[model samples]
Target chain A: MQYIYAALLIYKSGKEITEDSVKAVLAAAGADVDDARVKALISALDGVDIEEAIAKAAFAAPAAAAPAAA
Target chain B: MQYIYAALLIYKSGKEITEDSVKAVLAAAGADVDDARVKALISALDGVDIEEAIAKAAFAAPAAAAPAAA
Candidate 1:
């Protein structure tokens, strides 16, 4: 969970989601950094459009879901 | 967010991702249930391969990213 948040935070901050950056974020958050997990996240995110995925997730976010006036 | 988590939980439990089911999960988790949000989640998840998305996310999960033994 924290790992995903770290990735999202990096993407939201307009920073590149490199292994070092992810580690830095996790370390800053006091999360025990795991090299393998960081690698997997980077690899999985490769060729993935963070902006688009995040946009889709954010679109589904309940906060953004305003009901239409009847 | 709780809303997404709720949807995922329902999917994991082998239940349908309907508005009512999502609301039930959220309510069970003591989250502030919002009808609009539930509707949005259901609509967004409609036709979406929840299993695939979750698998991708899980694959990237650091806990699951156990590195090959060196």
Candidate 2:
């Protein structure tokens, strides 16, 4: 019975979105606190651009399925 | 001005968790696919008790902070 929890992050003032910062946000959001999954997600984001990631995910999301029939 | 999309649903076998099967699993997981806010998160999960709403959202997601500084 695995469960998935989802969240959005807003960083403290001028800090760069680092793995550490991401970790901090996730911790603040209290998500998957016991596992290293949050850390992994943060690390996976390294060197990647944030706005770009958001755009990509946002776009890809719409392709998951067609609107249900009426 | 706002965006949040997260999803997980496994059904089509015995069908019961309605709101039209969680609006057909958020329109088959293309989530927020033009918003109705996934039909208000499946009618606020009507009549509640899906494992106690996943144990109160996995224990209020660990109390939203407290772990960072090591």
Candidate 3:
């Protein structure tokens, strides 16, 4: 959700989603950055329309599902 | 990210994460489905303990680091 939140931040702030910005966002939140995963996610998000993606996020998966199950 | 969410759903739902479950979660969220990526995520998480992963999630990779750099 943080990633989504960061993207949300980027969108809201009218900033572009890039490695540095994402890193900055995570750092602001005192979060650790995983180099490999970050790369993977960025790659995954290539060409993705953040606005549409975020809109779908709300309806996407259950937020509490994984933790509750485990 | 959706992959992680699906894993979380698996953990919370107390269900083992199979391809089908991930598909279900993605379907529910109304998110775009990526078969290759989903398979890759499931494979990547093979021996992972979800609790540890989630706990680490907050502390792990920056939720927004990737695309911003790309």
DockQ of each: 0.03, 0.04, 0.05
Question: Which is better, 2 or 3, measured by DockQ?
Answer: 3
**Candidate 2: tens digits of C-alpha lDDT, residues B4-31:** 2222222212235445444433333323
Q: Report fnat in order of the candidates.
A: 0.00, 0.02, 0.00
Model 1 TM-score on a 0 to 1 scale: 0.43
The residue pairs found clashing in candidate 2 are none
lDDT for residue B13 in candidate 3, whole number 0-100: 89
Using TM-score as the measure, name the better of candidate 2 and candidate 3. 3
Per-prediction TM-score of chain B?
0.73, 0.21, 0.72
Query: What digit string (tens of lDDT, one per residue) describes model 1 on residues A1-70?
Result: 6778999899999999999999999999998766756765686689999777766555455433333221
Complex DockQ, candidate 2: 0.04
Ranking by TM-score: 3, 1, 2
Error of 2 at A37 (Å): 2.2
lDDT of each: 0.72, 0.38, 0.71
| TM of each candidate vs. truth | 0.43, 0.33, 0.44
* Off by more than 4 A, model 3: A57-70, B1-70
Off by over 4 Å in 2: A1-8, A11-14, A67-70, B1-70
